[model samples]
Each structure stands twice: as C-alpha cells, then as structure tokens.
Target chain A: MASPKILIIGGGPAGLSAAQDITDAGGEAILVEQEGFLGGTPKRLHYSLLAPDLKPVEEVLDPLIDSVQQSGARCMTGAKVESVNSGRNGFTVTISGGGKKVEEKVDAVVVATGFAHWDPHKKYEYAYGVYPDVIDFKDFEKMLSDGNIVRPSNGQVPRRVAWLLCVGSRDRQVGKFYCCRLGCAVSIKQAMEVRRINPAIDTYVYYMDIRTYGFWEDKLYWKSMEEFGVKYIRGRIGSINRGEDGRLIAMAEDTILQRPSEVPLDMVVLATGMEASEGTRETAAMLGLELEEHGFVKPLESDSMPVSTAVPGVFVCGTATGPKAIPDSITEGSAAAIKALNYVRKRSIKVQARA
Target chain B: MPIHEKNLIEKEDLLEKEKAVVDGVDVSGRWNTFIRERLLSDYHEDFVEEVKSLPGGRTVTNCWQCGTCTSGCCLHTDYGLREFNPRYFIYLAQIGNVDELKKYGDVIWRCISCNKCVERCPKGVKVEEVVHNIDEVLRRRGVTEDTPGSRWDRTYLDNIMATGVLDELGLTLKYVRAEKPEDFTRGFMARMAVKIIRNGNIRTGPIRRRTRGWKKMKKVAEDILERDGYASAK
Candidate 1:
C-alpha cells in the first residue's frame, strides 16, 4: 500500500515536530511555513534561553529543525496556504510562494499554525510604541541575543530596568482574557538573565500574579527573587511615560503596600502574551474548522482528544490549539501526528474493503 | 467581582447598608455595598515638576514607589509611626493630592532626614529632600498648619541668620516655648540642659560673643532664602 501523504501547516516547532513524527512513521509529510525560515517564534525572535532550566534555546530548537530537515519531509518556506478544499477522499491544499502556486493532495492535515505575540501597543498606557525604551518581550529577547541591552533613546546602559507583566494578556480591555502560560516564566528567566549579565543593573518585575504554574517554574520564580535579587512588585503598571531625561517612567500601585508608586527606569520591558496567529484563523476558516473564542482551532474534545479538530482529517497542535510552551507544543504535535496517521490508515483500510 | 475592581475599592469609598429595604427589596447584604466612583479632577498637574524644582528634589519625579523609602525610613520603623510613610506622601505630593496630603501633614514632618531612604532608593530619589519639599509645598499652600517641626525649623533658621551659627540652647528653648510650652518646664529639654551644663558646653552667665562674618553670612543666607521664595526671607 502507498504511504499516506500528510500536509502540515505552519513550519513552527509544532508543525516541524508533527512532520518529524509522520515522516518517521513511513508517511510522506509536506511542511509549509509563512516566513522565509523555520523554528517559528523562537528563531524569529532570537529566544536565546528557555525557561525553568535556563537551557539554551538552540539546544531544543536545533535538533527539531535537524529532524525536520533530515526526515526527508518536503519543507516549503515562504509559502502560505491560499486555500484548503475538503473532498470525499482527502484535502487539496493550495500553497502560494515566490509568485508560484502549488497544489497538493494529502490524506490528512495537521494545522499546527502557532500563535502571534500579543502586541503591547494594544494597551497604549504602556507607551510601548510611543517610548523608544519601552519594549516588549520579543524586543528584549533580541536585545539579549544581540548584546545591545541599552537605552534606545541615548544608547546608555540602563541602571534600572522594570519588566511589566500581562501587558496584553489577562486583560479584557485588550480582548485577551487567557493567561499566556509561559509569560511569567519567560519574564522571570529574562530578568534573571539580565541580573546574570550585570548584577549592578537593578531589575524589578511588576506582576498581578507570578503564575509560574508548575513546581519547576515556581522554583525559578523564587530563584529570580532570592538568588538573583530581582525585585518583585505585586502590581500591574497603570501607565508608562517618558521621563524628561528620556527614561521610561512606570506608574503602578504597589498593591502589597497599597501605595501608588512610580519608578523611572532606563528601560521598561512589557511581558506580552500570545494570541492566535492570523494564519491560524485563515487556515481554520478555509478548512471549515471550528475556532475557539480566542480564534485557536477548537479540538474535538479538549479533555481527551486535544489533537482532533471538528474537521475529520484536519488536526491541531501547539498554540494552534491554544497558548502553550515549546515542550507542550512539541508533545501536542506528536499526538496530532499519531491521530492523523491513524485516520489515514483507517480510511485506507476502508477504501481497500470497498474495492 | 473582578480583582481589579477589588483594588479600586478604597476603605473610604466602601458604603454598606447594614439594614435597609429599597422599594420592597431588602438590599442589605454584601451585594448592597457600593464603592463610590473615584473622580480626580483637582490634581495639581505640574505638582511633580513643582517638587522637582526644589533643591535636592530634582529626582522627585524619579520615584517608582517601591516602598524602599518607607521600608528604610527611621520614622516609620524606629518610631513605629506607620503614618510616616515617605512613599505614600511622595505619591501624594507628585499627584498634587493636597487634600489627601493634609491627612499626612502631622507625620510628614517626622522624617528624620536620616538619608537611609536615600541610600536604599533604587531610583536615586532624594527621599529626604522630597519629604521636605512636600512639607514646604503643603505649608505654602496653607493646606496644613505650622507643625512643631516647622516651628523648630524657623527657630533654627532664625538663630543661624542672627548669629551665623546655631545657638543650640536658645533655639531649643524658643522652639519649645512656642510649640511645646509644657516640655519647656524641664522634662526632656531640662535633662538635656543639665547634661550640657555638666559637659561645660553652656555659659552660666551672660557672655558677649559675636560671629566674625555675621553680617556677610546673614546677607548671603537672606539672599538665598529670598531667591528661594521663603516667607521668612525678610
């Protein structure tokens, strides 16, 4: 019998992992990414370090990219899924790239289209775009990678830096009511990194809650405070403005003390959250897949079949299903691949019986 | 309902109808409690800039209210004067909440200028100067009356202007006579005076002495006070 061909949307961690799984299981997999490169946000944003363990991001991502490359999966970069049509037998996915259109028929599809970083500018009070020194987590990651963690206004080393948590998440005003699960851990990790780089640089983290979730992350949160001496202020910043000297001034009520406080920082990092990627929405719409309230593809049963979507042969993993960390995304990707492989195999068996 | 809403509930704004019925409805439970809307239109918008203009207060606008100042405050800790919150008063002064600041006027003058808050301030806010500036602004605005500390300040300055040196005994007696007449009788001040007498730091009889550059020093100090808009410059 011929191997079942599967089309995996999004060339991110989840999509790459799913392709790896399908290809290893004797199935031909075609992976499509919108950007010109693979590795998704972790690569695009230059995330140098991962949370909980402080492992180099390359340690996790390099192997995944190598697997996707070595597995002989047809990897198409700079390609976008223009349309997806479901037929009696399978799916016809039309991908557009570099002024060329390619049509491919696949037995099953894995929609691992990941999430977009929530734009901090949506919450204008943070003065993210207005102030040069007020940056989001992606920009902070880039700064860390590039070793340019200086005030953009004057190119001076920031003596005091503050990380504001939940810039675009857990706030109904910005329409993001879900916690971007990794935001807290990522901020703690980044703050610790900043202290490690320069212990003289004063670091403060303003948060509603340090929602590190699990035990390992909880330890990391404490380590950030106890070991690194990174100050934790229990308050979401009310507003941020540029000081006269070009420093970013963040105003927040220290809820623990029940006092309104303002700190003039050389730089302010807004720990932005994750939202459904535009591609995720477009793919869901084209495939007639059910989207959750937040625009992620709704799984057939979240409690059991998290990888199975409403659309029969189309599955979702990683942030396509919702906001998740890299490890969780990889796990879901493999799970979705197994479900897709089973569906293709079962359908082929039925086709043979009919014949 | 929401946590943010819970934060918006100030103790003063909380209204509880203990036993009440409205239009045949017994709206007397926890649901009946209402938080008054906070409307802040009376803000002195340039208050932060105003405080920043004073000497040693250039970084008043730099405070991020980390409670470092309050935590390191000698008045707040040693004296256990919880109301002597340097962080809270700095916030009030920055926002120009004069009415709210008046509530803290009695304790604002208690800042010992120990410079501990200054040393501990991560943002480099001259907390001691900012506290004094707040007191100065409040006194200038007539929001608060002259506190015992303010009376002591006046006596200290007057002694310096007159003698070009601090007349410790004269200033202390004058300040106590004006502010705490009961203390003038020999409790804390009397015990200190006895110690000074035993240490040979006090003259038993009237002795004639003058500061060599009294006139020049007085003129310079008066000019500075006048330029800084102090009412006692004359």
Candidate 2:
C-alpha cells in the first residue's frame, strides 16, 4: 500500500507538530495555514512568555516551527482548506489562497484550526475602544514584548495598574459560557511581570475566581499574591470610566471584604478570553464536522476518542475543540497525527462502522 | 451595620487537639485546628427546589456565586458587615446545608433590598429576592424562634389593634414587660458568684452576640480605656 497522504489544517504549534509527527512516521503530510507566517497567535500577538514556567516563547515555539519547516511534510503557508468531500475510499480536499486553488486526495484530514482571542470590544461597558489606556491581553502582551510597561495614553510608567478577568468568556451577555481556561494563569503571569518591572505600581487583579488550575495554582496564582504582592480582589469590575486625573476608574464590589470600591489606575488590562476562530468555524462547517455550543469543533467522543470526528477519515484536536493551553494543544496535535495514521493503515476497517 | 469581629466556625466547626501527634511529629497549635467534615443528615435536598417556587425567588437557581451581589451589597459595603453574604448563603442553599442556613436566620432578613446585587449579577440572579426567600424559608420552617425584631413588630401591631393610638409610653411598657427585663444585680457583681466558686477567672466561651448600636459605645469605651487604662473603664 502507498504510504497514506494526510492533510493537516492550520500551521500553528498543533498543526506543525501533527505534520512533523506524521512525516517522522513515514506518512505523507500536507500542512495548510491561512496566514503567510507558520507561527500562529504567539507570533501574531508577540507573546513574551508561556506561564506556569514563564519560559521564553522562542524557547518552545521557534523549535516546533523550524522542525515542521525542515521536515519531509509539504508545508503550505498562505493557504486555506476550502472544502472537504468524503469520497468512496478517501477525502478530496480543495486548498485555495492567493487566488490559486489546488485539489488533493488524502486518506485522512486533521483539523487543528486553533481559536481566536475573543474581541474585547464586544463588552462595551469596559470602554476599551474609548480609552487608550484600557487595553486587552493582546495589546498588553505586545507591550510586554516591546520590553517597556507604560500607559498607552501618556507613554509614562503607570503608578497603578489593574486586570479585569472574564472579559468575553464565561459571560452570558456575549453568548460565551465556557471558561477561556488560560485567562487566570496568563493574567497572573502578566501581573508578576508588571510587579518585577516596577514594585511600586499598585497592581490589582479583579476576578470572579483565580482559577490558576492544576500545577499552575501555586506557581502562577499563589506566587503572584505571596511573592509579587499582586492584590487579588474577589470581584469582577462593573464598569470602567475616565477620571478627571486622566486615570481609569474601575468600579467593583470587593466580595471578600464585602465592600464597594472605586479604584483609579493609570493602566487597565482586560484578561480577554478565547473563541473559535473564523477559520475554525468555516473549516468545521465546510468539512461537515460537529461543533459544540462555544463554536469549537466537537470530536466524536470527547474523552475516549478525542481526535476522531463524526465524519470518518477526519480528526480534530487542540484549541479547535475548545479553550486549551499551548502545551495541551501540541500534545493533541501528536495524538491526532497517530489517530489519522492508524485510520490510514486500517483502510479496510472503516471508522464509519464504529459510528 | 453590625461589626461581627468573631467567627462561629472556630467555635462550631473547628476541632482542635491539645497536642496532636501526627506520624511521630508534634503538629500541635495552629496545625491542630482541623475543620471537622460536615454531615449531610441536616441537608434538605428539596429545599432549593422549594425556595425557587416562592415569589421573587424564581432566579434563586441562577446564582453562580460570583460574589457580585455580596460585593455591591449595601449592608456589607456601607455597614462593614462581613456576615450576611449573598454568595455564601446561595452556595449553602445549593448544597442543601439547612443546618448552616438556620444559624444565619437572624441577619438574613437584614437585606435592605438595595438591588445592587440584582443589577450587577452577571448570571441574572435576583439576589435581594433570593435573600428574602431564604429569610422566608427560615421563618416558615420555624427553625428560629420569634426574634426580638418580630416581637417588636407584633407588639406595635397589637397596640394599634387594641387602642388605634400611638402611645409611646404604653407601647414601651407593654413591649418591655412582655420581654421581662431581669436585673442580675450588676455586671461584675453578677459574675462574682461564678468567680468565687472557681476561685479564679471563669473560662467562659465568647459571648458572640450581635452588638449593633452598642458597638459604637464599645469603640468609645475601648479608646478611653486604651488611653486612660482599665482604671478609667472601672
């Protein structure tokens, strides 16, 4: 049998890892990315550090990008998977970008189309568009990458800073009810970075829950409190208004203290959550893949068979499924590759039979 | 606002060992005070379902316990009250902790219906109404005795019914006599009998009474005593 040709959608860490693994295992892989660059959100957003360890982004992301670029798999940057049609024995997928289209026949398809950072503008109460200082995590990370923490309005080091958690995710108003999963840990990490930059800055994190889950609980959440003196307030901000002093005024009820507080700060960072990317939604719809309430692609079985989809010869993984951290996405990428490879190897045993 | 400077958890929930020997090591003092696990025997599974049926309590099930209601609660923010938390009570109600709910009956009715909680609740939980429902549940179950507040209300209504006139002196006498004020001689004098029997200071537990208005006078007493010493307090 000719080695199976596998089509991987996306060119991020997940797609890169999927392509790398399939190529290493002697399977022909075709990786497609919508963006011209291979690196995904991290490169786009210029993320400085990965939390829990606070390791430099380059340390983790650069190597994966390099390996996939150098691998036997055919990498197609600035390309998109236009359509997927399941034929008699395999899938015929249409790839198009830059006004050119190519048709390819593949034994399996892996949808690693990752998520998008939720648009903070959906929450008008925060006044993100109005105030230059009220920035979201994407802007905040870019500022961090620039290596100077300053108020966007004045270009001076801020005396006071605040982070508003649960911006778009876990909110009914925005029709997003799932936890973004990365909001707490990332905000805590960012807060720690701010404190290291300037200890005098009165840093506060307004939150519903400091859900720095698993191993990150101690390293990110508690350490940010105990080590960095980052104040964690048990309340979400009700609103943000411009003060006469050019400071941003945040109104919130301090649930722990059971007191209403109006704190004025030079900079306000909104811990924005994630949602299914437009590409992810389009790909899921195009490929006839099931989607969850949050618009992320739903696997055939979430726990037992995570990578396989309802459509035979198609697999889904990473943040394409739901809100996930970087490492988990990479791990899912490899898992999806193995599942796709297995499906190709057992061409006689149809996954449709199991369905 | 009542300044509750103590915790009922320490008295009621915490179980301490005098000298705890944990795996051949003396993990006594701070480590010894372990919170005893609660029993589900007092848990009424249908209580939450029943509470949701009441008026203004339809949104009782909608609380995600984000603490938004309690955060903006006037009784807490303006009054500096740590107890009477909407989040705390809602959580307790969800888990069917009827025993715990009964203990807070006195102050559960203290909600002034500011609706700050209702306005700001992200989950659309009508918090003030839920609080009212909790108070109603406690009152209907007869778990708490007729509080002094209810007794006063009853006394005032009865005065109106009996004479249909506002007689302040008559109302005061009727209310006071019904309560039956006991003269225990004096403050220190009352404790003299127990102190003499013990031949030392009596080790009574904390008298955790909700000192509402008297707390203001107590602050004044504390300031004067701190500056002038216990002699001035005498």
Candidate 3:
C-alpha cells in the first residue's frame, strides 16, 4: 500500500509547524486537528496582556498556518483517531469522526497532540462544582474575551476578583508534579488585565511564590505593582465557601501576616496546570512510542534522532513531548521533519539491501 | 551492597527459606517457585507474545530498562523499602506473578497513589494504577499485613468503629490510656486545668456517643472482623 503523503497528529502550533517543516523539506504532510480551529491553546488565550515579544496568537501563528496551507499540506480538522498499527512497510491509522471511520496509511506518524488543562474538580475542596464563580484560567480567558468581568451568579462586575495560583499543578495530593511551566506568568498577566480594566476593583493574587524565573520578569512584576496595582499575597487558598450573597469566600492563612483571613471575592480564577492530552496515551500505544510519566510523548534520544521513537520511523514533537513554548514547538517541528526524512531514506536503503 | 553480595536469583532463593505457607490455599496460577522463576519458566514466552499483540503492551516491551521509574519513585524515598520498583512491578505484571504480589502489600499500600514517577518516567509507564491494581489483588487474597503504620491505623479505625465517627478527645484518651496510663491521667488533669485557665466550661457529656446508626455500624465492624481477612495482631 502507498503510504500517506505524511500524517501529523494535532492541529496546534506544534502540528502546524511540523506540516510546514515537512513541506519545506520537499515532503507532503497532513495536519490532523482534534479541535474545530487551528491555533490550539494559544489561539484560545488572550495574549494581549503578555510581554511585547510574545505577540498575539493570531499574529504569531498566522504566517505558519498560511505557509502550511500554501505548501499544500492537507489540514483535517475535528479528526479523532482511535488506533494506530505499524507494519513492515508503513503505519495504518484509523480515525473516526462525522459518522465515518477513515483509515489512512502513513509512512511515519508525528504525535504533537499537545496537553490539556488539569481539571480542578478532582481537588474537591475547591468547590469547583457547587460554586458558579469558581473557574480556571481558560474560563477567565473566555470571560475576558467577552469584554466583561461579571460574576455568573449576580451578573455584576466583580468588585473583588481573587486569582489563585497552582490550583492543580505543583500539588502532591493530585499527583501533578513539575509545575505547568506557564501558569504563574499567565496568572500574573491575567491579574494585570483585570486590574487595568477596573482600578476600583480589588485584585488579589494568592500564590505560593512568584515563579517569574524568566528574563525580564522583574520588569513585569514592577509593572503589575506600579501600573496595575495588583496585590500579590504569598499564600495558598486553603478552602472556598459560598457566602450568603452567592459570592465565593476564599479562606487562606496569609503567611506574610501570620493570620488566617477570609476574603469574600466575586470570582476565583484557579490557575490550573497542564496535562498531556487524552489521545497521547492511545497514540503512543498505536505507534509503539515511548512516553514520559507526564503522559507527554518522549522525544528522540539525540539531535540526530529527532523524530524517531524507540521503534524506528515513529516520531513526536511539540507539547506531545512536554510543555514547550510556541517558538520551541516550531523549532522542534522543523527538526522532526528533517529527522523523519532521514528515517524514510534509511528505511528505503535497507529495503533495497534486502531486495 | 547486600543485594549485590550474591546473584539476585541466589539471594531470592535464600529469602525463600523464610517463606511461610499460606493457609487454606491449594492451586495458584504459577507453581512452587519464586515470582521471578515462575514468570521465566512457566509463562515468559507465551506472555511476551501475548503482550506484543497488544499495542499498549507492545510499547511496554520497548522499555530499555533505564530504571527512571524506580529512581523517581516517592514510595521508595519515603518508606525506605523497595519490594517492587515500578519497572520491576510492570515486568512482573507482564509476566503474571499474581501470587507473590501479595508480599508488597505494605509498600504497595503506602503508594499514596501519586503519579509523580509516572510523570517523570521517560517511557511513560502508568506506575500508579499498576501498583494499585496489584494492591487490589493482594486485598482480595486477604494478604493485608500492617507495616510500621499498622498501630496508628488500627487505633484510628478502632476509634472510628467504636464511635460512629472520630472522637478526638476519646481517641486521645483511649490511645494514651493504653500506651501510657499514668501520662493519660496527668493529661486529663492538665486538660481540665487549661480549660479552667481559658475560662472554658468543661462539659461532662459523652465525647463520642452512639448515634441512630450505631447498631448498624457495630454489626458492620463485627462482620468485617469475621470476613476471613487478615488483621494485625493485637
């Protein structure tokens, strides 16, 4: 059977970048996206509040998305793959969507399916289910995009908005270790946005510690204080309860003050951590790929082995491997293409030798 | 160093000398050998082929034995015990050592079910659930042996069983009374004195009295004891 032009799983930054990479390397690649749209989480995120260098998701990913399209990379949106089986010649991919099960034969599979936000409902004490106003960063982003900061219960502009950090990430209880790598910065950015919009409103950021470990972090911190007047308290919110007025009252022992205080907030934004996407495990199995405990796809061993799985010809890129920035995803995507091309060429050489 | 003193197989063989006969058991899935041996001799070839047929199992077979899962294990660090590393456990599970798995009841129970090792493993092994499943199997076999934590666990369960819920005051009283009767007497006096100092009135009411469902709860506890399950020695 003739192998697929090329099959790239995931429609996000990583998948798109890999498609572009493959095209640039004079190979045909297909980009399969689970979601209806392309840009992934970055597109869903409100990046206007982020640093200047980190351009808006639309502006940043536009060129790459365009390049993939222009380069004749077939983009399949809303594709849910069920299984993958590799044979001596190529891989057989079975995808089910839109009342049809489509099977595609591909020479190599690049898993860049990315990661999902860890659900906060598992941490039952957070009252995520009972409380209407308790939400995560993704919810906050959508609310911010709607151009309103109103509580769902009262439909009133939130006077007191508490942004909670490390809701699911960095918690031993939930088994999610190794911080989500972006939640802290994202929380700070979101808090600044809220503060900028309504100076009269009370903005409190409850955090274990400000993990702005990146360069130019000091500038961001200072800007949050001087420009936006964001109040950052060093402590974790222990419990959340509903007030008589249907507002969320967050209780935390303010370590700096050495006193437990209850803050009645109109909204609580739980900055949840990222986890490997659901498809990752199944896809890893299908391709006979290796995964890290985090459920992210394991990367090739060295620079020379960029896209190769433990089993030859199977490859992985982007957040499929681990949590990575967009720039890194694009870089790895290109590197993966080069490696895939090399793998195919080598396999063909072996085939000729056997013949 | 001790594990390295002799070959692993020899060390295991010597350890087998201390193996106690399980009461009222006849047939096991594997024969009268240690877990490693039974796995290799009776089942290795067929099980390997079986797993290779499974996609998930195929990926499992690709493990290069880097020991990353074992090295990153929290259970190993916290308990200072390693009856089964995540890597070894997976290997055994693949080879079907269902009987010998009961030996890891304590270490397996202490898992806290954390996925830390799973997240850090470069090979993406499901370490938490695999250990948990083994623990479930052990639980079914009535092989629950208490570790060092058995004493406090028993006391806690006893307190809960006696009183529908926990009785902090009563629990402390009972635990202290059993462990240190003289100290408990002094503690009682100190508690009264502190309450008086704080101007808090000490109520002589029951610390934890039986509620409406107390009868049902007692019956349940009695049933649990007589269920042919292993209990820690008093």
Candidate 4:
C-alpha cells in the first residue's frame, strides 16, 4: 500500500524536526502550520545561545526546513486541522483555510503543537490588561524589536525595570504548580538582553527561587548578579498597579527585607509560564490521546522512555510533551519520528512474515 | 599498676550500673505496648484496612523503608521540610502509629501534592493519595486550624458544598482569620475605615459573591457532597 502516510501538526522546531526524520525514514509526510511560516517561537526569540554554545535558531533551523521541503514532504502553511477521527487502520483529518475544506487520510499522526506563554489576565492582581506598561516577556521582546525599551507613558529610558519570574508558574493558587522547565534560564537570558541594550538600566528580578540548573548556572546567575550587579530580589510579587504618571508599581513582601515594598518601575515584564498550545486539547480529543493536568500531552513513560505518548499510533515530542528549549525540542522531535517509523516498519515486517 | 587497676575497677562499677537497668527491661517487649496503643486504635485499624482494600495498599507493607521515594520528591526543593518525606509517613502507616503520624500532621499538609513523589516511586506507592488520607485522619482528630492552608483544605469541600461557587472574599477572610488574626484585625478595621472615608457601600465589601448562578452551582455542588456524604462532621 502507498507509503505509510504521516501527518505532523505544528511547524516549529518539533514539527520540522519530525518532518526531516520521517522523510529520511522513507515515509510519506504532510507538515501543517497555522502561521504563514514554519519556524515557531524560536523565530520570535532574539536571545543568545539558549542552551548556550549550541547553534543559533537561524543557523540550525533554516537548512532543516529547506531539507524537509526538498524531501517530498508537502508543507502546508496557514492550515489548521478542524477535526480528526481515527480507526484501527488510519486517521481521517479534516482541514480548513485557503478557501477550502480538505480531507486527508494518514496512517499515523505526531502532535508537536508546542506551548504558549501562560495568560496573566486571570491574575487580576498583576494589572496586566489595566496597566499600560505591564507586558509578558514575549510582548516585551516584540516591543524591544520595534523601538527603545522605554515606558509607553513617558519618553525616557527605564531607570527601574523589574522581571517578575514565575508569574503563572509554580503557583498552586492558579493550578500550575509545576515549574515550566526552561523559565528560570529564559528569565536570566531576557535580563541579560536588557543589560546589553542599556547598561544603566536598573534590572531587578523578583523570584521565588533561581533554578539555574547545569553548566550555565555559574555563568548566567553568579556572573550576572555578583559581577554585573543585576539585583536578585527574593520574593514573589503580590500585586502590581499603575502609578500616577503611568509607571508600573510593584508591591511584594521581600522575604529578605521582611517587609512589603513598593518598587516603581518604568516597565514590568512577567516571565509568564508555559502551557500546552491551544490546539493541543483539540488534537488530543480527536486522536484519543491523554493529556497531563497542565494540558501537555502525557508521555507514555517520561522518566525512562523518550517521546512516547499514551496512544499506540500517536506520539508527541518537545514542548508538547513538556516545556523544552529549541535544542531539546529538536532532539525529542527526531526521537518521536524514529518511534513512528519503527511502529510502521514493524507492522510492514509482520505483514511480510505472515504472507 | 595499682592506678591502672583502680581505673578499670571504676569503669567496671559504671558498666554494672548500666547492665542493672538494661536487665530490668526486655528490649523486644518495649515496643509492643507503644505499637499496640497507637497501631491497634480504631483510626489505625480503619486506615490500614481501607488502604489494603485500595489497589496498592498491600504494597505499602512491602516497602523496605528504602527512602528513595522521599529523596526523589520535588517537595524537598528548598521550600519543603526534609522531615516531611512521604516514604517515612508510609512506613509510619505500616508500623500502625496513628498518633506519631498525627504529630507530623502539619508537615503532611505542607505537601503541595506535586505528584513528583508518585512519579519517582520505585514501588508505585500513590504517595500523594496516601498522604491525603493521612491528612483526613488529622482533620478527624480535631487538630487546631493553625494555617489557612491546612484549614481551607480540610473545609474546601464544605465551602464548595455550602456556597456552590468559591467565595473569594470569604476565602481571604477565612485565611486571615485562621492564620493571622492580628493581620485580620488590622485589615478588617482598615477596610471599614476606608469604606467610611470613601463613603463606599457598608452593607457589603468591594468583592461581592456572584449569587446569580450560585444556587444552581450550589445544588450541583451539594449533590456531589451529599453523594460523597461530606455534609456531616467526621
């Protein structure tokens, strides 16, 4: 029968990574992305070496996308699968956009939809929507790209800017107690970016804990704080409000100080947590896959195994499994592709043996 | 030789005194009463029987007190208490000392229930669930509501059952009252004074409960409670 059709959802590092592997393994594949382009958040990110000293997103991803496109795997941009139904043999996926409703049959599916920045609107105390200068880390990045990192209220470079790490993360009150794996390091990277832009800017990171695990621990945290004088305030932000002149005012009980202090800031960027992409729930429902409490597709056995989902035919990799940086996502994506190929090829072998 | 001999004689005298006390008590029998008093109680009996009836209750006894599960837990990550390991709690359950378990009740409540313990457990102990049941035992014993954390959890179902929707203001009030009454006293007076100053509504506070779908939600919540039989005091 026609080469076991493979359909991969999401076009980010995970999706593209899976596509490359699937093509190499001699499987028919279709890679679909909701955005106009293939690269996901890594495209939006302008930080230096996330897993430090690793290849940059542009250097590594550009060629992979090209190779996957050349490998006969059809790339569909701005396409979304509306619904999917699976049977014993294969899956029927209904897609929309490009002025038409189309259907495709695939023998297997890989979910790599990745993750989204956790919404802080639910946290009313943060005054996210009400305050002009309160933006999530991603929005701050976009603002930085456009112009100076100055408060929108006044036309001056920020004297005091605060990064409230773990806004929606590691908070049981909000039902997300699990650490989003890469958030701590990501916050440090962002703070470093601000310092690089304007050395004079007073950067204070309000955190419950600084979880700089592994090699960059000494370099990122110790060097940034002791050597460069980035303030590591030990506390969680209790609330944030807009000041008279429109500057952001943060209220937090500095555990070290043992008193509540109001720090006036030109801009407050909440290093928001990560959650499974919006599409993951829908995709999981269609394919009869399991999702963990945080909505990430539950790994079959994450501790020992790699890139295996609960379902027999379906698999998930990268941030879709949990919050992961680009390098980890790429590695997981390749592992997931190998897992799918093994399943399909094994079935083919069984058939040949039976005959 | 006489001085050395005198020292040996003195050491022998001290050893005789220690042995006299040791011989008066049987080492094996010493633990029997302690175990019987706490372990054979109705609470311990019920906890053990209930756990045994559950899927892996028998496995709780199979634990070798390895302490691996506790070591692997994320609850010990800086904020957590080293003494509050779930594996030790399980061992306590196996030994049947309900009182010792009760003594460590607050620490058990300190568990954020992250389930890292469950995931890492080599023996597949439902660490969170088992600890949750132990917490139930503490609540039944009528321990002081020390913190809003412990009290809210104990009465969470009841609050949801009575009001239908979680009363945000009520929760805050309950928290303030349970944990820090002084903080509550200051906050309450401050709110009242602020209300008088601003001429805000005194009949109710700034945060009001949505009584709209509350009745319906309350009914649904009540049904769940009645089905679970949580309305009555344990």
Cα lDDT for residue A76, candidate 2: 88
lDDT of 3 by residue, A1-355 (tens): 1233568888778888888888777777877887777777677565344442534567788888888889888888887877877788877888776778889887777778777788989988888867889988888887776668888877899877888899878888998887877777777777777877776676777888777666636555545644565656667998999877787878776554344557578889998888887877777777777777766777666456555678777778777777666777778787777777777777877787989
| Candidate 3 lDDT by residue in tens digits, B1-234 | 233323335345432323344576543433234433212211122333333333233344333345777776776766666664766655544434444444555666666656787787664555665555445444544556544334445687777676566665565566666566454478676776577547745322464466577877677666766552425222
lDDT winner between candidates 1 and 4: 1
Query: On a 0 to 1 DockQ scale, where is model 2?
Result: 0.02
lDDT of each residue in A1-355, candidate 2, tens digit only: 6888999999888888899999999999999988888878888789988998999888988999888878878988889887888898799989997899999999999998898999988899999989999999999999998889999898999987889999998899999998999999999899999889877676777888878889997788767754675656578888998888898888777564454566677889999999999989999889888898778898898889988899988998889999899999999999999999998888745554665
Residue-level lDDT tens digits of model 1 in A214-270? 775446776775467566667788998776777766777767446566667788888
Worst lDDT window (10 residues) for model 2 chain A?
A254-263
* Docking quality class, candidate 2: incorrect
Candidate 2 wrongly placed segments (more than 4 Å): A348-355, B1-234
Which residue segments of model 1 deviate by more than 4 Å? B1-234
Which window of ten consecutive residues has the lowest lDDT sum in model 4 chain A? A46-55
Q: Write the per-residue lDDT of candidate 2 for residues B21-87, one digit (tens) a residue.
A: 9899998887777665433322243676567667676667555456888888899888988787988
C-alpha lDDT of residue B212 in model 1: 98
Assess every candidate by TM-score.
0.63, 0.61, 0.56, 0.58
Instruction: Give one clash count per candidate, in the order shown.
Output: 3, 0, 6, 0
Q: Residues B118-213, candidate 4: write the lDDT tens digits.
A: 787655667777776556545645642444455666466555445445554465556666667565587676786576557644333455545677
lDDT, candidate 1, B1-234, per-residue tens: 555657546788788878889899988867588876554422353565567667766666565567988887788888888879988887676556777788787888877778998888876778898899889878877878888777777777877677665666677667777777664676777688888889988753345356897788778878878867675534
Ten-residue stretch with the least lDDT total in model 3 chain B: B36-45
